[model samples]
Every structure is written in C-alpha cells, then in structure tokens.
Target chain A: MTTDDPSFSPPSFVPFERLCLIGLGLIGSSLGHATRRAGAAREIIGVDRHQPNGQKALEIGFIDTLAPDLETAVTGADLVILATPVGAFDAIGKAIGPHLSPGAIVSDVGSVKGVALDVLTPHLPAHIHLLPAHPVAGTENSGPEAGFASLFDGRWSILTPPEGSDPDALSRLTAFWEQLGATVEIMTAAHHDLVLAITSHIPHLIAYNIVGTAADLETVTKSEVIKFSAGGFRDFTRIAASDPDMWRDIFLSNKDAVLEMLGRFSEDLSVLQRAIRDGDGATLHDLFSRTRAIRREIIEAGQDAAAADFGRRPPSRADDSKF
Target chain B: MTTDDPSFSPPSFVPFERLCLIGLGLIGSSLGHATRRAGAAREIIGVDRHQPNGQKALEIGFIDTLAPDLETAVTGADLVILATPVGAFDAIGKAIGPHLSPGAIVSDVGSVKGVALDVLTPHLPAHIHLLPAHPVAGTENSGPEAGFASLFDGRWSILTPPEGSDPDALSRLTAFWEQLGATVEIMTAAHHDLVLAITSHIPHLIAYNIVGTAADLETVTKSEVIKFSAGGFRDFTRIAASDPDMWRDIFLSNKDAVLEMLGRFSEDLSVLQRAIRDGDGATLHDLFSRTRAIRREIIEAGQDAAAADFGRRPPSRADDSKF
Candidate 1:
C-alpha cells in the first residue's frame, strides 16, 4: 500500500497467456501498466477505436501489441476485457463475440455490473466464459498517458459472475485481479449495482450536479467561484471533472439504482435544509458528528489516506516567502 | 506556492504591538503560526476556554502567552481576532468588549460574516474598530497540533468592514493578512455570506448529507461503502470530516443564504434526476462537460492544484510488489 515508495515492486505472476484490453483510456491503460508490472499476462494486446490512445499506450510500453480493431485484439487472446464506457459494451460485445477463442474468459471494467451482464451475455459465445467486473478505482483524468501501474493497489475489484459460472474461469479471473494488486469481491450483479448506486453512482451525480449548480449561479460570478474554490467547493470539482461520456453512461445504464439513491439523498438533504432553516442546531450537530465517524472508518479501512486534506501539499514557510 | 518545500521563509513585519487570538483550533492555531512566522505581532496572546487547547498552543510556541479568559487575553492587545465558532462570538465579544483598549481593531475568522457583525457590533465600544474577515483556507484537521504557518499562503482573506469604519484600522488589518501570505479582498458582510454559502457552506452540507445517507442505507453495508469508496464517495468524506460544532454554527448563522443555495441545488438536482430517469444521456453529458470546464478554470486561476486526484499519491510498482 506504500505506493509512493520507489524501491517496492509486486511479485510477478502470469495468469493469462494473452490478455486483450479494448479501450486505452485511464482504466484500460492503467490495467495494461499494472498487468505488465505484476506479470499478470504474458502479452497485453491493446485495442482502442481512437488510434492515438493505442499509440500512446504503445509508447508507454505497457502493451505488447496494438491492435487496430476489436476482432484483431481478441483473435488469439485467452482473456478479453472490454474496458470502454459501459454504453459501448453492447456493440463491442457483439462485434468481438464471434472472434473470441473457445474457453476464453470475457470480462469488463465498467462502473455498473448489472448492465454489463444484461448487454454482454446475449452476444458472447457459450464456449467463452463470461464474467463481469468493476474495479472501484479511478482518477479524474483520462487518456493512456494518465495511467500508472499502482492505480489498483489496495483497491477492490468486484466480480459479478452469473449463476453456474465455470469455477476455474472465476478463479483465474480473481487471480488475475489479485496479481494486479486488487482485492477481489464476488457478488450478484444486482447487488453490485445497488451497492455502487449509493457508493459510486450517486456520489458522481451529486458532484456533477453541485458543480453545475455553482456554474449557473447568477449571484456568484464564475471567476469568483473558481478563485475561492479552495473552500469545500473545490473538492467536489475533482470528481466532477471526470470523463463526461463515461459518467453519462453510468447514470443512464444504472438508472433505477441511481434514481433510488438520488431520491434518498434528496430526502435527507431536505431534512437538513429544514433544520438549517429552522436553526435546529441539534439536528445539524448530530448528523455532522455521525458523518465524521464514517470518515474515520473510511481512512481506517484504507479506502482513503488518513492525512488531512487528502494530504494535499500544504503551504510551507518556503511557499509563503515567495508571496 | 510550493508549500511543501522547506528552507524557505518570508520577510517579517509587525502590524500590532500585541495580538490576541481567541480560539485554539485549526484556524486559530494556524493564525498563530502564520502570524508568528510573519512577525505580525510583537507579542502573541492566545485564549481558549478549553484549558488543554490553550496550553497546547503555548507548548507549540505559536503564542508568547496563553490566557484562560477572553477578558485577560484582550486586556492590552492592539489587535484581537475572534477565532471561535460563530455561535461563541456573541458571548466572547460581550466578555472582551469592556476590557479592550481604545483604538484596538477587533476582527474574526468566522465563516459567516453577517453574524459576526451582528453579534460583535453591539458589544464593541464606539472607539473600537470591528472588522470581520475570513481566510478561505484550511485542512480538515483540528486542534493546535494541526497548526501550519503556510495554511493561508496564496489564499484569499476577505475583509468585511462596516460602513464608515476607521480607514487606518482597515488598512492595517489588510496589511496584516497580506503579510501572512494572503491576498486581501474587501466586500460587504452580506456579499461574503452569500458567496461563501455556495462556495463553502452548502458544499459541506451536501457532503455531510450524502455521507449520512450512505451510512443509513439498509441494502448496502457500511463496510461495502467504505471498501469501494475510491469510486467517488471518499471525496465527500474528507469535507464531511471537518469540525462538527464549527459547521453547525456556520449553517445556523448563515441560514438564509445557505437555504437559498440549497433550494437552487435541489432544483437543479431534480432536473438531473429526471434526465437520468428518462435516459437523457445528452442532458447528463452536457452538464458533466460544462462542470469539467469550471474545474479547468479553477486550476488555471491557481486556486487548486492541476495534478490528478488533487495530487494524491498513486499506487506504484513498489506498492504493488507488496501485495
């Protein structure tokens, strides 16, 4: 978990002879880098519809071969991962199904698990083992150059294998994520979607919504908001800056769960709103105190750094001297 | 501002013969550190109703003297800053008003500006200057041990001077903040409250609200939420961990503006919810894309670090090797 240490490296183990990663953005490229570092795959064959992303991954040296198309990428691969936005899964699944080798394990790194199963299962060949997964990790940045091998270190990769899945295939996929430095959790796709709805999907929606609200404020100038953002507003912006298309797909694909959670969030917010309006300090204090404990749990759980302000670089004597 | 770099110190100037700060938490203690570093006061007097907090501030060497009571702390100080939560301002202002020296300039570092003026103006004598200011900076941590001199470096310090205030007092307070490594902006008390309601107050509210909602979910275990927080929930928890009492006072003191902004936020969120429920990808994508631009503007304005994940430490090869 000491990801910043230069002298550390994970043990190398190959779980797949050929791994085809379709999509060369942040998650895809990061998987390539981590797989190479962990020796999780003998060869990482990368494919992106965007040629420059593939070229950048090649330059980054995580991918052994850059394929121009999905069919070419999956032709001889034993493990094929669709790493694109969840919205793109249906077409990619259909296009690459006929080309996948028998006994190959097909998986995904999308944010929503249920949709992956709903869209991918129908198109995949029965000969190929279909397993879906979501690595609950990412930064706000995109593109191949944004990737790093340690992105998954100490993170969770939740797998949603259908009922009666091949145990060997499930074990191998779990081992693959483990080699890449992620702890694996197995759950039903429905459960995974519901859990992520509260944890991931809704948080992203709220971040995006708050940022949008800040932007449309007629009373507050956009420049003023930007300049004074070191206030709590800036924290929301980090996640709001995440890839638009990907999140759009997440919100649309996981519509029911997201709406359910959003309703609960708004309901809770209204209670706080009433409390603030009524100057109900006790209610506000109780909720704020309860939330503080959760943050401690998160840091203790190693889901976040224990350092204050996410260990952001604090102004030092040296920094002040310049002003 | 390169605040993490050591071996740097700023030129020092003293604006007050004796300065008293009336709280020993994150902002107050940081003020002591930054003030001492800038040589802003010939003698620093610290006051905290909490005996341990006062002793810790003295032990940290930021204060030349620790006073157990506000009256004793402000006895002969030329400048006094009320650094306690907004709720305490009324009592402290009342206690210290008769004890303050003539021509002394009194200020505060409270988040709600209008409340500071409302609570302090009545207690303060005609000869004393009541200038309220807020330094828009801090980490989530609290207490004297969390003090850092560079906390305000490159941040804004907004001064809300009541009408026909002493020009010399205002100028001196502005210079004191500048010397402590902050840029000074003068605005009305009401404007400061409204701007910050969006920039700071409501963001904290939404963060606290969401974390509470997550903790209350029956379908999703708290452990699952914590383990998978990297997806986005963890970002909110950072702000949610901020001092509970301080935030409780902020919401109560700035009720109108916070409520107004919250109403707008809810209206906008309702639109997003509808869009998601109706499968309007374009609506979600457009807002997400627009918000990303604001984040870029914030970075370009030098209000936030441009580094991905707020420059959070990413997993590296060595980190993976451990797993």
Candidate 2:
C-alpha cells in the first residue's frame, strides 16, 4: 500500500459466495456497495434489527437480499461481518454461532478491536475463524442511503485477528479489503484500540465535550455559537455530529485507552491554561507553531484533504456555496 | 442581509480616498484585494514592519503603494485599518496617532474586540473616530500571498463601536464591510468577546492542546499519529495550524472570557470522562444527539458550506485525490 510499491497490482482471489452483513448502517452498507462494485461477493445478505434500514439497503442495491432473522442470514454464509455497535457483538455472536457454516470467516467493522475480541471470541464457535477488522474511514453520515462505493478508497483497513488464526482465512480477508480499495494493516487487538484511542476516540470525546460546553454557556447564546461557528467551533460540530450510539459504545468499550489519552490531554491543557494566565506569549506561540508541522505531515501522508479550509467550495461557486 | 429582504441592493457609500492598512497579513491583504475589487479605495497604502511582506503586498497588487514608516502611512489617509496582531495594536496606535489626519476613521480587524477598544482608544486623537471591527472570517493560511478577494463574501463582520462614536463614521465602516460582501452586526465590545470566546478561542485552545498531547504520547509515535489522523484528529489540525502570533494575542487579550469558557469546557469534559469510565452509554448518546441539531442550524443559516465531507471534491476527481 506504500507509494514505493510501483509493481503492485490488485490481488486475484476467490470472492465470497455468500457474505452476511449483520448491521446495515454507514459501514455495513458501504461495505455492501464496495463489495458489489468490486465483484468481491456473489450474494450480499443484510440483517439489520431495524426493518426500514434492511429494506432501504435492498432498494438502494446495497444488498442482494434482506434476512428477517440472524439465523437465516448466517445459515450458509462464507463470511459474516458484525457491523453493529460494539456492545451488541456478544449477543450477536452467540445467536449466529450455531447457524454459521463450518469454515465461515467472522469479522467486524468495530472501532474498539480489543473489546470486540473479548466479547465475540467467547461466543463464536471454535470452527469459525474470528477476524476483527476496523476500516479507518467514514463520513459523519449514517444509514443505508449515506453509503457509497468509494468511501473506502485509499483508506486504511486494520485487521486484528485472534492468536493462531488460520493463515488462509487471514489472507482472504486481507485480499477482500484490498479489493474494496483499502490498504490493509495487521496488528494485535490491543494495539489497534490504543492507536485509535488517540486518533479517533479521544478526539471525538473532546469535540463532544466542547460543543456541550458552548451550548451551556449563558453569556454566549446558542444562536451566537451557530452564527460565528466558522471561526473554529463548526469543525468540532461535524465530528461531534457522528452516530451517537456507535460512539457511545466505542468510548465505553475502549475506556482505559481513552482515559489515559484524556488524562494526557488535560495535563497539556493545564500548561496552556497557565500560559494564558501568565501572559506567556512565547510558550503559546511555540506550541501553536509546532502543531502546524503535524498538519503538514498528515497532508503529506495522504491522510487528509490538502485544500485550504478543508476543501470547501469557494464563494465564487455560487451554485454549490450554501450562502 | 436576511433572506426575506426582497428589495435589498448593495449599498453605494462614499469610498475612502486613501486607505492605509497597518499590516499586510491574511486579513490585511484580503481587505486590500476586496476593497480594490469593490472600488472602495482610491489608493491602498500598506505598512508592514517586515520588508519582504511589504514588497510582496506591492508586487501582488494587494496594496497600491508601500509605506516604509507608520507616520508616512497615516499622514493623509482617510481610513487606517490596524490589521496587525492584537498585541501590536497599542504600540501601532501610539506611533500613528499624531500623524492621523483630521476626521480619519481608525478601525481594526482584530479577533478580540474588547482588547482592540481598550488598546487603540487611548492613543487616537479626539477628532478621529475609533471603530473596533472583527470580520468573523479567515482560513488557517496566512501571509500576503495566501489571501483572496472573496474571503469575506457572505461572512459576518462584527463592529464594536464605543459609546458616543460618530454615527456617520460607523455607517461608513459598516458600508465598507458590506461592500466587501460581509453582513454587519454591531454589539458592545464586551459581548463580542464573550461570544467569540465560546465560538473561536476555546475551540482553538482545545485543538492545540489535543494535538500537543497526541504528539507527546510515548506509546504512540508521531508517525502513527500523522498516519491515522484521518480518524478525527485531522480536523483539529486545520484549526490548530492557524497563525501562532495572532492566536497567542487572542488568548492573552481575551483571557478572562477564554478562561471562563475553558473552565466550563473542563467541567463538561469531566462529566463525559466519568460517563465513559462508568459505561454510562445513555448519557453519552443523549449529549452526542443534541449537538447534531446545532450543526444543522449552522448549515441552514449559511454559516458553513453544506456539502458532505466539508465540501472536499469526491475521490473520482483524480487531480485533487491524493490516492
């Protein structure tokens, strides 16, 4: 997946004969669309607790069929992806384990890999190959209609397979994600959780907390917050507007790493607070200047959009401009 | 500027004969380009202590002429806009006070209105009108060349004029910003600081702090942080990459309001931290859901671009796609 691999080509591998997706929200539906686009799955069956979402997924061509029950969905599936909230993985694993065919590969798109391993590994059948994966890409949108085939393009898909898993099953899962346009990385479940806590979980917690603080301010009315949000606050709102249920499950499931990161953030914030209190312009300027290099590195690594103001349309593009 | 106004027209007010900008950074250069585009200034004179910045401003036609000293710049100017960092306002005001022409209007484009008023008011002559203005618009990019004429289009420009200020001067300043395509709102300096403290200052502080924390993590290397930033941290980097000098002054100048907002933010964060530690999913879910409505209002009010993913071009646009 690195740029240095000039001889690289998309791997040729057998596609899944029957792929069962347990949740048809943003990630699941997106996987459906991407797999369909890549011809990686012959039959995509969606099983969502919400009937409307399953129906919408079928109508939008995100799935070939919608199963009314978990048993029917996993009956003969070659691959089963648990895309529900991380908290539901234990129950879902228990329900689908008996129904899953022998040699079935079980995977997930959960944010908290360590918790997913803990909860799902105990409930799944030993004959099944459990592979926990996290696709490190998404929009702030959710539901079937929000899914897109290109959502995983150039993104990282991390696989945290259980210890001593079948090498054949791991290779197949890696190739599957590769076909979906994602570069694959393999790591331990605990490492994945810690990495994401700093990159995603803690960042989301801060955004949610800041928005709550602004909304509660008595001196600065809510109307003013919205009106002047372009200053900096609006960016936080976009991240904070993410799916609440999924995020809540993630924070709780990955509590220790998130707590550790939060402690570090609070300590750093105290230093900044002291700098402000003491009118230490040098300290503030030095810290602010140092962070710019990290932004450049992110852009250079192709991890973010490089355009100014997050690639927003200029005012001259009146048709697209909200104003 | 309300959407309901059917008979509205762009105001045609008396333009400045000589507009002297005391700094030629992002805001100053953008103002120069905008005023020139709108025919609001007959001659734009730029004064920058950095010689190269003044040269670039002249070369780029951001200013019609470059003044080597503050005295020469303010000698015959009808308008003097202090577009430097807020920390420099006091010294700039004192330096140019005696040379300012009679009946001249002295305004600024500082982020903190209260500090602008307090610092600039004491140095200006009795006959000159002092107007503290904040164009609530900017990108993270700075310098003379990193500006565009349309930067202020459809943005808000807040004015915090002192009591007993000349009515005509206020109207002229308002019309000037309106000509540059900003909607004008007048408020007390104190209120403006409080509103911006919540909307801008505190958000930047949090962004800067979090990025610093991530960079300092021993377990997570800086390369990993940069590689995986797309998860959520990338958005904060954009705001954190803002001009260090300008932000340092903003925090120091609006220390009281910013500290108040920061305190509230810390308290809210503690609540969220406890919820995560206790696995209080309901509390986290409820708070996350409420913030989405604020994002909707910001989009509906045209304060932000409405396109998904912050209006970044779709990946199919091969020229802009990093992958």
Candidate 3:
C-alpha cells in the first residue's frame, strides 16, 4: 500500500487487536499517532513512567487508553513495544516477561538492535516472538508533545529478528511499519549495530564532543560560540540537544561498534588535522569534494530534502509568528 | 535599524558611490543583491575569474555591470569588496592595488579575517583604507544562482579593522553592512580567527572528517550510509558538501587557530571515547545534558530557528513538486 494511493484504506488490515507502547516520549508518542492513523491495531494503549506524558498522549487522541504499569500494559496485548531508553531494557524485560500474552510479538524502537536482543531475549517467554526494530527517524525534542503522525514518513525502519524466529510475526511487524509510512529492511542485529554505528551513533558522538569542546574553551566564550554559530557550529548543536538519557544508553549499549567507528573517525580527523597544520590544500580539497557526492545520493534516494538549508523557511518577522 | 520596522527606507543613506564586488559567486552575488536593495551603493560592478558567473550576476540584475578584470573593477570605485575564496585574496589584492581609487574603503566578505589583513595589508596603498569583515551566514549551495538578498538578514557581520585605520571608512563600511540587514560587531583579526576556529572551523573539519570516514568504511557500503543517513549522518553531510575550494582555503589560511582548536577537540574526544569504552553512562549523560543548553541559547539569541529539524518542512509528494 503506497502512501500516495488514494484508494488505500488502513482499517481493512488490523494486524494486532491491541498495541501497547511502554514509553510515551518522542518515538513512542509518534508511534501511537502513526499506529492510530494507519489503523494497524484496533486499540492503542500508551504507558509512560512519567504519568503526565501518558496523559498527554491520551489527550492527543492517539492512544485509546493509558496503562498504569508495564505488567498491566502488556496484559492481553498482542503487540507490546518497549520504547524507553535502551539502558532500561534489561529490567523492563524482566518486569513485563510474565505478563505478555501468549503468541505476542515484542518489539522496540530503540537505536541499538544488538543490545535489545541481548537484554530482552533471555527474559521473554519462548512462546513470545521478540522482534527488535529501529525506526531511524527523530527530532531533537523529547516527550509526547514532540510527536506527530508523519514522523516516519519516507524513513527507514530496520527489523532484526534473531535466528529461528516466527515468519508470521516478522511479516506482521513489517506490515505495521509500512502502513505507518516507513520502508522496511531486514538485517541481522549485529550488522544493524555496525551500520548504525557509522551512520548515526558516531555522528551524534562527534556532535556532542564538538559542542562540549566549544563550551570548554578558555579562549572562545560560550556567548561568542552562540553568536557566531551559523558559520556551521549551530548545525551540530541540534543533534547535541537530543535526549541525554536516550543517547547515553545508546553509547553504552553499542559500546564495541561505537568505539570502532569512533577510532576510525579519530584517525581520519588526525589526518585532516595534519593536512591543516601543513597547509595541504590538495588533500583537504579532494576529501571535501568527494563527500559532496554522498550528500547528493542521500537527496536522490529521498532520504533528505535537496533544498538549501534543509528547506528551512528563512526567518522573517512575519514568519516568526507562524512558528 | 530593526528588520521588522516598516518605516525604514534604504535610499536615505548611501555609503558608497560605486560598490565593486571582486568575484561573482554566492557571497559576491548576494552582496550585490543586498547592496542594491539597501541602496547602499550607487552602482554594483561584479568581476569573476569565471566570466559566465559575472555575466549571470549582471543578468540576475544584482550587479549593474560585469568587469573584465580585477584592476578594471576597482577603478574609480569608492568601495571594493573581495568575495572570492580566501586563497585568491593575495594575488587579487596585488592586481587591484594599483587601480583602486584613493580614499576607497577596500573590504572583503572572506570567512578568515586574519588572513585577509595579513595578505592584503602590504599590497594596497596607504591612501586606501583596508577593512576586513565576515558575515557568519551561508548555505551549502554555491555559485551566482544560489545568491539571494536575504542571505545576510539578521546575521552577524564581524568587522576587523587594523590599528590606525580611517574612522570614516570604518563607519561607512559599518553602515553598508547594517543597511544590508546585518548586526555588526567589531573585533581584532586575531581574536576573530580564534573565536571562529572553535565555533566554525573545527565544526566544519569534524564534519568533513566524519563524512570521509563513513565513505572509506569497507564493512558499511556507501549505499547503506546514504539510506540510513537521516538518523544523524545526513546533517553532517550538508556542511561537508560545502564548496571544497572555499573550505580548503579556510583551513589553510586559518591553520594556526584551526590546529589549536583541533588539538583541544581531539583531547575532549579521547575522554568521550574512554567513557564509552568503560560504559560510563554518567559522564556521557552529563556532557550531553550540558550541550542542550547551548542550542537553547542560540535559538534565544536568534542565531538559529528554535523549530525542530532546523525548521525544515517535512517532505511529502506535494512538497516534492514545490521544490
């Protein structure tokens, strides 16, 4: 069902009778909205450790009901998604394991898939299907208020099912993500972690590190950094502003792959540092030119907008009020 | 004058009799458009090593005429602005030094201010005032076609005048930048380089390095890198795609400050790498949380839009046609 097809209707295919989201932050709340819009489930249940977030999701009209606890949330649900920080997965897996209904498909929207499998698989029942999926889309903001139904539109959702997993559960989860406007890809949990290490995790780590470096500089004041940020610093700050707890968990959970990529990044950076110090314009120019091709491919793949400045509407007094 | 004030008029204050823009690329063409709109100069003469670019700038109506050479462009002009890659400034300064009218305020829109002063100071006659400035604003896209009048609106224009410079020339250049909708700040060229090294130069170098590392990975194919880029990697690519020649010049010209900042960045990154390797979530979380405040401050200072994803409009089938 292509998103552009006018005759397409989501109510015809309800994969799960009830869908329970265990966290109501940006990704969780967005899932709630998209799930409801796609009619992938007959009922949507939202649960958050912070009660107000669940209340906000309910008021937003995406979730039909709010669950008080994880055990209660998983009870009677055919599909239960763990959507909190990856660090919380181990304890959460144990807490909700006994309460998950038989034949339930357990998945997550976590950034790191390898860790999800390691922490969650031992706790879940053999009868339950554990499918770890990551939707590679998000904003810098957090909480229920930061979500919208279109968050996953045209984004990639990778599902990593362990060996000997049920085929029916795999297709069912794939269908759910596709209905919510994501293109799905299946890969091994190990490969997912490796791929994401370079594409997502390392980039975020660099952004955070650079922002920290700028702030700590005795020569350059924080105010100067902020004032002159448009020269390129401001872009890094956006990703740096992402949920601290969520990112902290991602780094710790995907430790090996993150470290490997970080090492490579550092090595590459050292080369650049040497080139700059020696005034090697030829080396710097070639690298900078080659990188531009990747940006073009991403735009052509419909992964990002081709417009300048990410198509941000230029700020004006009139435009400020609209925001 | 505030950008929001409807009563503001441009023709009331003309700062220069003839505005000679010595390079018809993005910044040069943009200066032409902005200067015309502000009525800050009586005429705009554009000169480019690439003749087609100068012709295009004239056709776009941002420039009143196209000059055949650097010497010809600065002849009889009261205001001469250099807008090419910083590396070209030395030769261009020498070429135009003989032709510039006495009492002309010669300035540039180069990113590196110290290099501008260092290279251009000895070539020009003392009768001509030399002022270097940098408008901390740009898009990744380059060339004359990418130029727009609003490029500098609400952005900071930093002016670095050498000691014993003419006050009238300084004030005139200041007024010209202000009329073009920039908030102007005066600083020493050395200080400007140091401030920009952390805030701008290091961020760009890091971006370039990360993109290069991602491209060179054997395990992760370039296709995978592009597909999953929206996760965080794509943002780095945008800045990495910036004009290679321009960036190469920036790194080479500002080598001392860039290397200084790169050293600190490497040191800071080592600490983060250690934290990740040891699974120290607390250290990671503390740094991540602190960086978010800087993003908030940038938005508050109007250096960037507060909207998520840099206020990029979400791509849809309908929006694709609009682009």
Judging by DockQ against the true structure, name the best candidate. 2
Where does candidate 1 stray beyond 4 Å?
Answer: A1-14, A314-323, B1-14, B313-323
Clashes of each: 6, 0, 0
Ranking by DockQ: 2, 3, 1
Mind giving the per-residue lDDT tens digits that candidate 1 earns over A202-296?
98898999899989989988877876778899889988999999999999999989989999998999899889888899999999999999999
Tally clashes: model 2: 0
Q: Write the per-residue lDDT of candidate 3 for residues A1-323, one digit (tens) a residue.
A: 22233653444345689999999999998998898788889998888889888888888887898988888899999999988999899999999999999999999999999999999999998999999999988999999999889898877789898998876787788889989988777788999999999999999998999999999989888888987888999889999999999999999999999999999998888888888878889999999999999888877767677777735544443322221
TM-score per candidate: 0.93, 0.95, 0.94
Docking class of 2: medium
Tens digits of per-residue lDDT, candidate 2, B106-147, equal 999999999888888889889999998999889988999888
Instruction: Give the per-residue lDDT digits (tens) of candidate 3, residues B56-119.
Output: 8878999888888888889999999999999999999889999989899899999899999999
lDDT of 3 at B70: 84
Candidate rank order under TM-score? 2, 3, 1
